[model samples]
Every structure is written in C-alpha cells, then in structure tokens.
Target: MPKSIKQINEKIKKGRAVIVRADEVPELSEKYGTKKTAEKIDIITCATFGAMCSSGAILNFGHTEPPIKIQKLWLNDVEAYAGLAAVDAYLGATEESLDRGIEYGGAHVIEDLISGKKINIKAQAHGTDCYPRKLLESSFTLKDLNQATLYNPRNAYQRYNAATNSSPNTLYTYMGTLLPQLGNINYSGTGELSPLNNDPSYRTLGLGSRIFLGGAQGYI
Candidate 1:
C-alpha cells in the first residue's frame, strides 16, 4: 500500500526516505512498484550547469548625515544603476565598465568585494538644500554596505532554441559571436544537464522548492 502523508513525514523525520535524481526514477520504478517507489523517494534534484543566467546584486549604502541625491554612480569602475534613491543602486553581473569596456564588470566587482577587497565608489549629484553634497568619492568593502543581496530577475530557463545567423555580417549578441553566413551554430545548455529535460512535468521541482544558489541554500 502507498504511504500516507503522515507516514511519509515520519519516515523523513527518522531519515528513512531515499533521495535520488529525477533521471533515476525509471530504474527505481522497475525494481519497485510505481506506488511503492513514489513513497520511497523523498526528494528529486535537477540541475542545469551551463544556462545563461543573468544575476546581479542590490547594495545599499547607509544614508549619510547630509544626504545627496545621486545622479550617477560607479562601483569599481563599472557603472551601476542608481535611480532608486540617494544611496541605493543595483549592479548587474553583465554590466561593463565604460572606460575599460568588458574587461571589468559587476560580476568581477562582486567577487572582489566578497574577497574583502576595497572597491572605489564614485557618485555625482546636483546640490540641494537638504542634500548639499555635489560630488563624493569613496572606497568600500562588502562590510561597509548596509545590505547586499543577489537579486537576479532571470536565472533558470526551462528550454531554449538554437541560434544561427544567415546574414552576411557578423553579429554579436548575449549568445556570443555569430559568424557571417551561417558558418556556425550556437547552443546554450547541455541536453543531459537541462533542468526541463530531467523533470519534464515539474513533479518534484516546482514553486517553493529548495535550491542551492551562489554557494548557499535558497528557495524558488
């Protein structure tokens, strides 16, 4: 007989339930009946290694005694969007430096900050009565920020199609360089490692599922 929810909970609490990848379901199902197999499996994990995940971090520098409404901001030479408030901005992983181009981006800045490296912070603003400072330049590490957290708008992709160029000119895109005249085809994720390929129906992996993200545990 299939186990009830209570029984499953008890088994999980007592460390008796088995955990396996989604791909192993067929083999386990053959050995045990489908109903019994479902009861035995406690968790299923699906992974996508090479997905083009756009990630970023929102950092808030505590308000200064005399605040200034920032019009422009730069973190470690990479420009960050600062239209939210006086001391709040978001730095994207793919954001490139205006002076240095793609050599340095928000991802590198984040990595440097995490490693306890001091990063240059430059801000410019028009002076006001309540916020009098016009120009400010400082250096800060991760410890100096009030809040810093990764906030990625789009991370995992269920599926994607291949891309190729038919035009006579080279095209540069987020998917990388495309040679002229369909010389090469570009694909994103590996078939075996795709999350959608492993869990086609979203059985165990869905909303509120626990996941490993950025060297820590997170939820989707």
Candidate 2:
C-alpha cells in the first residue's frame, strides 16, 4: 500500500503519526517486514554527514567612522573574496592560510570567530568619494560583525563512498590519512540518515525547505 504525503501530514496534525529516525528504518523494516514497517511509520527525520569541502560564509564587517570599499581582503591570514558589496566579503572554508598552509584556514577562522576569539582583519581598497578609506587593519569577533552567514554550496550528501589510496606513498586527505596500497580505508556519510535517501522522490523536501545549519535555522 502507498501512503500519500497529505495522509501522513493529516496524521501528524492530529498528533497520531509515528515518527522515527532514518537510521532506525532498516532495522524496523527487517523486524516487521517492509510493508508493515512502512505502515507503522509516518515520518523519518534525516540527518546526514560527509566530508564537506564546498562550503563558505559571507560576512559583513559593518563600517567604521570612515567606511572603506574593500578591494583586497583577508581574514585571519586566509584570503576572502571582496568583490561583493562595499563592506561584505565571502570567505571560503577551504581557503588555506597565507603561511599556515593546511593547518589553519577560513574554516578555523570561522570557528575562532564563533568561539569569540579575536580575528585579525586586513584589507586594501581604492579610495572613493563616499567610501574613502584605502586600507584596513583591525581585530574583531563574531559579535563585532554586522552579519556572518555560513553558506555552503554542498552539504548533506545523498550518498558517499569509502576512500582508499592505491599508491605506493601515503596520501593526506580531508577524510584522513589514506595508507599506501589500500592499507587503510576512510569513508563518509551517515547512511540512510542522508536527506535525499530518506525521500529519494523529493516527497518531503523542496527548494524552499528549511533546515538547521550549524544549529541555526536556514533554508534551501
């Protein structure tokens, strides 16, 4: 038997629908068989994870007594794109620090900002009539900024596979160290809990769907 989303939603409104985690669906289906399990469950809450690389944040540094149009920008030694509006810039998570290489970058900078740690802000600008300042160097935290919006282009994978290296030398990866000649295996994703897998047909999610990103409410 098939259950329409409307029917499930009706049960939910009446507080009679049964909700379960996506991780539990496999076991439940095995215990009671797929048909019975499907009838018993009305909603599945999906929460998935994987190595996220295509992610970044847009930040607004507010303004100073003499506002500057940032032309070149860096946050905590990690470069950011400042081609947007006057006081705003986009910081990519994978942007490596100028001297720290892979050790520290935009991701760490964002974390430090969120932790209320001081972040060194640097920028250069062409003096303008309205925004005349040509250079900026200062320190601030998350609270000191007008806005810090984390916008990841890719997140919550539908499915992902384990990683392995077949080379003779060790490989450094975001997933972790991949040993030589397939000596070790690294993987990502939380299996069925992945959003798309829970509703492969786009039954419960869409363009305007809302989700919680980093414990903050966001939309798709």
The estimated TM-scores of all candidates read: 0.72, 0.81
TM-score of 1: 0.72
The residue pairs that clash in candidate 1, if any, are: none
List per-candidate RMSD values in Å: 4.2, 2.9
Q: What is the lDDT of residue 122 in candidate 2?
A: 91
Give per-residue CA lDDT, model 1, range 1-220, as digits (tens). 5556587678789988777876687788899977888877876556654545477888898877578888899998899889888889988888998788989888889889778899999998897898898888989998899988775446557477578899999999767799999988887765655566766687656777777755557677
- Please provide, for model 2 over 78-172, each residue's C-alpha lDDT reduced to its tens digit, 9 standing for 90 to 100: 99999999999999988999999989998899788778899999999999999999999999988888988988667745366688999999999
Best by lDDT: 2
**Alpha-carbon deviation at 187 in model 2, angstroms:** 1.1
Query: Where in model 2 is the C-alpha error above 4 Å?
Result: 27-36, 114-118, 156-158, 167-169, 172-176
